[model samples]
Target chain A: MTGNREQLLALRQATVSFQGFVAVDRLDFSVAAGELRCLIGPNGAGKSTTLDLICGKSRITSGEIIFRGEPIHTYREFRMARTGIGRKFQVPSVFRELTVMENLEIGCSREPGVWHNLFRFSGGADTERLERLALLVGLQDELSTQAAHLSHGQTQWLEIALILAQDPALILMDEPTAGMTAHETNMTAELFNRLRGQHTLIVVEHDMGFVRDIAETISVMHQGRLLAQGTADEISEDPGVREAYLGSGGIGHA
Target chain B: MSGKLTRQFLIYGAVCLCILLVPVVVDDAFLLNKYARYLVFGMLAIALSLSWGYAGILNLGQATTFGIGSYCMAMFLKLKTVPVHTGSEGLPDFMVWNNVTELPWIWVPFQSTTFSLLAGILLPALFAALLGWFIFGGRIAGVYAAIITLAVMVVANLIIIDQQSYTGGFNGITDLAEFSFLGIDFDAYSASTYYLVAASLTVTLFLALAVSRSKTGLILQAVRDQEERVRFFGYDVALYKTFVFALSAGIAGLAGMLYTIVMEFASPTFLGVPLSLSIVIWVAVGGRQSLIGAMLGAILVTGVQGALSESEAFLETWTLIMGGLFVLIVLLMPKGLAGAIEALVRRLPQAGNGRSARHTEPDHRPETHPNLGGTQ
Candidate 1:
């Protein structure tokens, strides 16, 4: 890791407990600006919980989350979004009834209040941005298509485009390529590679191939705690990563 | 977009033209007055559609707002009819009959026509805003919200029925003086009042259409389909819901004031569950998602009921037949009459804009190939 890169987000001793069952124990984690980090773990390893804590989806039991040097653990989900953090759910959640262009336009809305939304008309600048975003996500051809009609990979790309429409500083994606074909996965990897150094991302994924393709540093979580963190190559060879995540399939499998 | 708006305007204009021709075509004053009553009901249906169809809030207590508006207008009219000119106590007959010696502080505000009219609209909207804030602010939705609103209607009815002196009890405020504004008498029996109702309905319909076509309307539907997604996008879901709920309430209030003028009375029945449920039915039968369809649905259903009840053989079984029709509509055309019409329109060769036609379908699509995505 570089020594001088400014920290964009930090979760210091954050914990989440549901009905006396600890989902995420007190744990400290931080990411630098414009860093693309991957979170990998076995089932119930608390990777998603970490993302939830940062996005204010789950209330932290007792800890601090600092975003852009300001503590944000107490903010609501929508407030956190206004502070420039966007999240992509594991299931692609787009407005099924609206067109692809409408979805992007909503994402690009500067003020989404009742009065503003009622009178706000999409200007030429917004249309240009929508077209540019659609092209970037490879959905320019389907701009007028209803989101419900999009294929699984296309929906995933649309969700990505929606998050980018917010122009957020930090993005948390839960399995960005869970149902994509091999080719689609390769394309997603390329998209993420292009996004690197432009936006900070914390992606929770299980596909080792996908992870190795886009990730520089991989953090392995186990039993609600950080088990290991290193380069994909270094983590693949670590004994802790093998015992916790790789299991019987040794590093040779990758 | 302009084409869609033009089509909407043509339909609205046709409806208005028919309404304008009613007095000329129909020789019977009774039938013309009945049609005027239907127009008032149509406004209520449009209000319900704005909330239920567009904003996704199933407001089962809509009539409570209507009742409030009606009572406000009725009180003012009752006050005017009191014989203050003959050196008699300027109290309505109902207040005098109930042995009310002094004017209540609440009734004092209704002395001014302008105050009464503003109260008729603002009171209901304020109540709706407060109730919606408590309900939606808690993030409660769907069935629970419906149950809560239905409960409110029941409570409001009971309160009106219990407060005999103030609310006129079960009989409600009656024998209202003819509504007059700016020295213009709006005789309930004349064509002038009918035109007033028609004009109000037209304005309400246009206002609703404008709101529904705005970007806010798209977001409201999105919130209906995926509320959490909208919240995750940094929009206040509760605030939007409350705004639409209050807007719907205000419209219903206006309709209530019209009902008082058309019927020459306001009763506790206006606040009852039956009327509230009927409003929902009208919107459902019309096409919950279509503003114009809801208005037409109200008129069609009311007209059908009138015709059926007047027949000698079907007099006792009219309600049963209406119930069956509602069930049939729900089962056969879940999207209601408007949805059916929209489907028919889409099939026509000239129905060029696919975007406008798409609003007729169900907003929430069932997840396809659910097993394809890996669980988190």
Candidate 2:
């Protein structure tokens, strides 16, 4: 299905070094429009660091990242977000002091300038969209509750809802279901499946079962480089992937 | 509007009414002048609350902006009084005392009333914007930001004291002619002057309240809660912080100008470390989260300090007593007076209703997502 789709994001030899330690070294990755690609690897495989590079959280030591045909490696974090890339951190990062509705309202705001938001109230359409976004994540009932008061699973869902509120074309999620219960994880997988073709997503996850439930394409990273790219079954059967996860319970056991 | 919002409006209305009616209740000119000064301090406290409480910027140099404003107005007033007070070359007496022949280029702009009035507010605002750009852009926050601001204020105070010729040094700028506008003289001890200060405070209070209720205000609170989260949400967080810092500085500058007018002088103490810390204390004691509460804190604290200091028996001990009181307030009421009242009010309604407070249904939430089951 993704064969005919144009490339939405591309990292051309992207390299990020922290004080001479190459976190992500000369990595090349690409995702087509309307594709849900899962990036899986053991801890410290530079999965999160790759997400950080794309989201402009960490600067690349060399090479370039292009999004929607624009060179985006030079952009700042907020500018990267404005360019239609929404990033969810490994740890849930919703505004704790604000109500869920307020968080959604902020996400739904199209104009990011301070003056533009000074007096502008969210319109009827934006308000409707916020409610819909809240319900999608099963947070409609918790819209008025402070985010700090939310359960960990609920907070994770709220972060998802927040990014969805922005209506971005590309969503990059780092460990979306990290601390979720089995039921919550299944629900998140269901949500990701539904969101597959609507928004291109690059999800970095360690839970192989969760990955199998939703991902249409799987990319494995090892030591800051792409080790394999194929369907879930192909990635599981790859000998290199097995060798990389040798001591760490391999693919199926993960 | 909700019940909470309605109650807030009513409380604000009461505060406004009392502020306007104070002159009517008090016949003594001296007392009115003193209240006027307290109102100016209240305005300064409101400024601090906007930056510290709303934007999460702890500006320890807030008094620098206030002092800058006082000096700006003082320069203009001093130029106006030079001919009458010292009788020489249309230059201020201090310039002659230092043996200076001409007005310095920085002081020359004060010759125009328009420049002086605008400078009194804009100078501090622009200065704050420049400072905020460096601080927030560098991602310096919390206690580090506080230390930087404190250092800036100390440097500013020292410079003013050292430049005795231009700034009137440690003695400051004094003996100014009464400020006149629209054919009315604002004599420091007159009812008109007190009215001006009161009116300015009322306007400042409402303006800050409006800002706190705006969408940007809500976002500012979000920034305060999660700075990194706000960044990923596509907000220029530094810009927001800078905007609020400049606004707070402008408000403080306005208060400073009024302070100079009410006290009939601009002193080095206006922007000194002691005054800056006092402003912070007022905001903390009142309720940092509530604008009106912070303003009232400033007025109440200043009023009590004045009363205590005036009595001969308590003169030397009042400072120690006030310090101890501050410690007690901080230990006992971490949220200040307003937070305590808000908690009490919240409990009263819930206790009376005895119904489930949890909202099971969102007012405008659609029951289902049509697009959820299938890809769009």
Q: Pick the lDDT winner.
A: 2
lDDT of 2 by residue, A19-102 (tens): 888899899999999999999988789999999999899999999999999999999899999999999988999888777887
Query: Over the stretch B1-376, how does candidate 2's per-residue lDDT look in tens digits?
Result: 3344556778887997898898888989999999999999999999999999887899999999999999998998888784665584568988778887889999998989999999999999999999999999999999999999999999999999999989999999998878988898998998999999988898898788767876788788888888988898789999999999999999999999999999999999998888999999999999888899899999999999999999999999999999999899888888788777777876886896565654433543453211110000
Q: Report DockQ per prediction, comma-separated.
A: 0.44, 0.53
Query: Which sections of candidate 1 miss by over 4 Å?
Result: A122-124, A246-254, B83-88, B350-376
lDDT of 1 by residue, B1-376 (tens): 3344556679888987787778887766677679999999999999999899887899999999999999999999988785543334667766777888888889998989889999999999999999999999998999999999999989999998998888889899988889998777888877888888998898898888778866687778778878988888888889989999999999999999989998999999999888999999999999888888889999999999989999998999999999999999989988799889877775884468656544432222221111100000
Poorest stretch of ten by lDDT in candidate 2 chain B: B367-376
Off by over 4 Å in 2: A122-125, B82-89, B360-376
RMSD of each: 5.4, 4.2
Q: Which structure among the candidates has the greatest TM-score?
A: 2
**Candidate 2, DockQ score (0 to 1):** 0.53
- In order, the TM-score of chain B in each prediction is 0.90, 0.93
Q: How many residue pairs of model 1 clash at the backbone?
A: 0
